[model samples]
Target: MRCEAAPSATSPPAEPAAVFTQFVVKLYSRCNFGCPDCYVYEHRDRGWAAQPLVMSPAVMRRLSGRIAEHLRSHRPERAQVILHGGEPLLAGPPVLERFARRLRADCQGLTTRVDLLVQTNASRLDRAFLETFRRYGITVGVSLDGTAESHDRRRPDRAGRGTHAEVARALTLLRAPRYRPLYGGLLCVVDLEADPVETYEALLAHEPPAVDLLLPHATWHFPPPRPPDGGEAPYGRWLAALFDRWFDAPRRETALRLFDSLLDLYLGGTSTSEMWGPYGSDVVVIQPSGLIEYNDVLKTVSAEAARSALHIGAHNFDRAAADPGFAAERAGLAGLCAQCRSCPVVDICGGGLRAHRHSPDNGFDNPSCYCADLSFLIGHVRERLTHGVSMLRARFVQGRWSA
Candidate 1:
C-alpha cells in the first residue's frame, strides 16, 4: 500500500505485491428508501441497477475464498470488512449472518486481526439485526445528516417524507448501554447552508464516539455547491468553523476524522485514513455482483471508472490490484497533477481526493476542484496549530516560574 510511484501506464512494469487492509463489500444492491445524495444510486452509477438485490450464495463463498487467500498471503497487521449497500440492512439479518459466518469460517486460521462492520442508513435497524451483529461481533455505523430539518433536505424516503425521526428511533436503540459497545459512530455529510456551529451541536446530541464529516462528492466537471454569498473557499471556511468548535472544546467530545487527520499530518505524524494524506490507498471494493473494483467514490466521475472487469469468480485480489487504475490510485505523490504537485500545500491536501481530481480532458491528472478550499482550510488549520503550540509552551514556562 505504501509505494512511491506507480508502474508506467502505457508499457507498465511488474508490481510488487500489495496488502489491502480495508475491503468494502456490497451486500445489497438496492435500498428500500431513496436518498438522493447516495453516490451509488443517485450518481452516475446505473450499474447498481443490474446487480442482484442480494449477493448470491455462490458469490459470497467465492468472495470469502478470495479474501481468505489474501489474508493468508499478506498477513497484514489488521484487516477491515465494511458491509455496504444501497442499504445493507435490506440484505436482511439472515443473509448478513451467513455472510459473516462464511468469512469467519474461511479465514479462521489467519493471523490478521479482522474488524467487521456495517454502514447503513438505519431505517431497517432493529433488535433483530442488532442481535445478529452483536452475536457476530460486528459494529454498526449509521448515516445521519445534521438535524431533522437539514437531514431531511438531503436524505429522505422515496415518498419525499423525512427520515430523521425513523433514523433517530433506531439510534436510540443502538445507544443503549448494552448496544453502545457496538456503536461505530455517525457519518454526516457537510451541509453548507446549515449553520456550522448548529450542525456540529446537533450531531453532538447523539453522543457518538466518533464523527465522520465528509465533503459532498464532486468533481471539476460538476463542482460542489457554494453558499448564497459566493464566498471564496466556502467549504474550507465551513470546515474551519467546525474545526474551531471541536478544537477549542474543554475536552475531546468526539473523534472527528477530518480534523484529527489534518492535525496529525501538520504535526509530522501519519494520518489514519486514506481519504486524507498522500499515503497510498490500501482499500478495495467488492460490488454486489462480485466485481472487484477500485475507489467507489469514482462513481461520481463515471460508473465505469469505479468498476473493472475483474470478478471474484475469475480473478484473485492480487490480480485485481494489478490493474493500472488500481496502481494509479495508490500512486501517492506520483498520482498528482503538475498543478497539484507544484502547490505549496500539496502535502497538506495530498492533492485532495482522487475522485475530485477527475476530468474528461486529462483523466485523473488534475488538481481537485476544491483546490482553493483545501489551501484555505489547511492554511487556517496550520495557523491554529502553530498558535496553540506557542501558547502551550508559554503556559509551561509560566507554571515553572510560579513553582
Candidate 2:
C-alpha cells in the first residue's frame, strides 16, 4: 500500500510505494473480427491504427525486463499478467508461448505467484493453441455476447459474416473435459436492447464459472444510445431486471460480476472490480510498441486519452506510475468530480468509470455519462437489501415472542 518511490543513491532517500500488480499486454493491435462496439478498433481511439499488427520480440523482452524490475522493487505477493489485444489470438500460439515463457522466466522468485491469462475472441482457438495455453498455465477467457443472434449482430468478421459458429466451436472445445480447467470464463458486454433474462440464460447454457457484464464504454462526448422518448434509465433498468432474476434463482448459477459487486458493496463489503467502489489504479497497459499507459478503456474517450510518454524500453514501472495519467487514476476517490464527491452513493459507484466522465471542457471532473443509471441501480439494490433484512429481522422477533 506504500506510495513512495524507491530511493536512489545519488538523490535523497525517498519513501517506498506500491507498484502495479496487474499488467495488460496488448500482443496485437489488429483484430480478425470487426466487433462494432469494440473500444480499441471501432471507438474514437485511432491509436491502434499506428501500432504494429504484432508486438516485436525486442519490445516484449524490454517489457519483460521492466516488469521484472518492478516486481522486485515492490515485491507484491501476487501479480496478474493479462494477454490482451484487438485479438490476442491473432498473435498465434508460437508468439504467445514464447512471451509467456519469457515473462515467467523474468519474474522467477520475484513474486509469490504469477497468474497468466488471455482475453481472446476465441475465433482461433484450436488444439495447438489450447496445448500451448495448458503448457504455460495461461487460462483463456472468451468474449461472448450471448445468444447467436445477439452475438452475431455485434461481432462479425471482416467480410461481415457472423462469427458465432466459430466461437461456439471454440467454446465446445474449451468445455471439453481435458481443457475445461483452462477455461477462465466469459466476458460479455451488455446489450440493453437484448432481453436480459434471455441473454443471461443463454450465457448460463455455456456453463462458464463466471460472467462479466461490462457497460459499453461511453462519455458525455460520445454518449451511449438512448431511447427515443428518453423516459428513464434504460441501462439501469436492464441491469436491475437481470439482478432480480439472478438473485431469485432457485439455485446458484454463474457469478455475475456487476451484480455481485453491487450486492457486496450494499452488504458493507468491498468490490474487486475497478468499475465499482473507490479503487486505486493497480493496472497498467503495455502496448504492442512497448509504450506504457493507463487502462486502455480510456481510449474510448479520445485517441490520446490514456497515452503516456513512458515506454517499457526506456522507463521502469516507477516512471510510468509517476506519469500524470497514472497518478490521477491511482488517486482513487480523490480524483472524482466535485459533483461525484457530493453524491450520497459516490462511495459505491466510484463516480462510475473514469473514462465515462471525460469531456474536452471539464476533463474527468464530471459525473459519469451513466451517472443517472448508476444512481438508479445502486438505489434499487440498497432498497432490496434493506427490505430483505427487515423481513428477516421481523420474522426473528415474532418467533422469539411466540416462543
Clashes of each: 0, 4
lDDT of 2: 0.87
lDDT of each: 0.87, 0.87
Q: Output candidate 1 Cα RMSD.
A: 3.7
lDDT of 2 by residue, 95-168 (tens): 99989999889988774488899999899999999999989899989999988999998899999999989999
Q: What's the residue-level lDDT of 66 in candidate 2?
A: 86
Off by over 4 Å in 2: 1-16, 398-403
Candidate 1 TM-score to native: 0.94
Alpha carbon lDDT at 315, candidate 1: 91
Instruction: Give the number of the best model, judged by TM-score.
Output: 1
For residues 1-403, what per-residue lDDT tens digits would candidate 1 score against the true structure?
Answer: 3355665688556556776778999999888677776788888879987888899989999999999899888798889999998799988999999999999888898999888999999999999999999888999999989989999988888898999999999999999988999999999998888888898998899999999888889988877887679589998899899999999999999999988888888878988765568866878999878988888898999868888888888998888777887888888888898987888877777888899888889888898888888888888988998899899999999999999
Pairs of colliding residues, candidate 1: none
Worst 10 residues of 1 by lDDT: 1-10
